[model samples]
Target: MKKLFIAALLFVGMVSFAQDAAQPVKQQRERLTPEQRNEKHLKKLTTELNLDTNQQAQVAKLLADRSAKAQKHMEMRKARKDSSIKPTAEEKAALKKEIMDEKTATEAQMKSILNAEQYKKWTAMRDENKEKMKDKMKERKNKL
Candidate 1:
C-alpha cells in the first residue's frame, strides 16, 4: 500500500512538470512598415470620423507626411542617445519650442482639412489618447 502511494505521487509530479514544459512561449509582435502603419491609422480615422473619399485622401497624405517627420525625429533622438550627449537648457528650450510650433501647424492643417464637427471630434480623441498615454507612463513609473 505504501509503495503504491509513493508511485502515485511521483506520477503526478512528473505530469505537472511535463505540462509546464510543454506550454508555449510568448511570441513577439510583428512589425509593420511605415506605410502600412499609416494606412492602418488612416482607416481607423476614416471609420471614426466618417470621412468622405476626398477627406480620406487628404488624411492619408497628412498621415504619411507626419510619419516621415516622426521617423526623422526618432532617428535624431536615437543618434543623440547613442552619442550619450545631454542638451543644454537653451537647446532643450529650443527643441520644446520647435515641437510646439510643429504641433500647432499640424493642428491648423487638420482644422483646414476637417469640418467643424470633425475637428471637434478629432481634438477630443486626441485629448483622450493623451490621457491614456499619461496613465500608461504613470503605470510604468510605478512598476519601476
Candidate 2:
C-alpha cells in the first residue's frame, strides 16, 4: 500500500512537471503583429456573427485596419509612458477626441457592412462586453 501511494505521488509530480515544461510563458502583453491580431478577431467575429465570405472579407479588412491603428496608438502610449513628461491637458483631450471619432467611424463602417439585425446584435454584444469590463475593473479596484 505504501509503495503504491509513493508511486502515484511520483507519477502525479512527473506529469505536472511535464505539463509545465510544455507551456511557454509569455509577457503579460506580448506583442502580436496586426495581421495576427486581425486573424484572431476575424475568427471570433465569424463565430459570433455567422458571417458570409463576402462579409468576412470586408470585416477582415476593417479589422486589419483597426488593428494597425491600435498598434500605432499602443506604441504612442508606450512612448508616453517611457518619457518622464506627462501629456498636457490639451494633449489628453485630443487623444480622447481621436478615440471617439475613430469609434464612430468604425461603427458606421460596420453598420454598412452588416445586415440590420447583425448590426443591432453587434451593438448589444459590444455594450454587454463594456459592462463586463466595467464590472471587472470595479472588482479589481475593490480587491486593491
Which structure among the candidates has the greatest lDDT? Answer: 1
TM-score, candidate 1, is 0.77
Identify the runs in model 2 with alpha carbons over 4 angstroms from their true place: 1-33
User: In order, what lDDT does every prediction score?
Assistant: 0.75, 0.74
On residues 29-144, what C-alpha lDDT tens digit does candidate 1 reach at each position?
46678899888889888999999999999989888877787777667767898999988899889877877787788899899999999999999998997787567556645643
Candidate 2 achieves a global lDDT of 0.74
CA error at residue 5 for candidate 2, angstroms? 48
Give the least accurate 10-residue stretch of model 2, judged by summed lDDT: 1-10
Give the TM-scores of the predictions, in the order they appear.
Answer: 0.77, 0.74
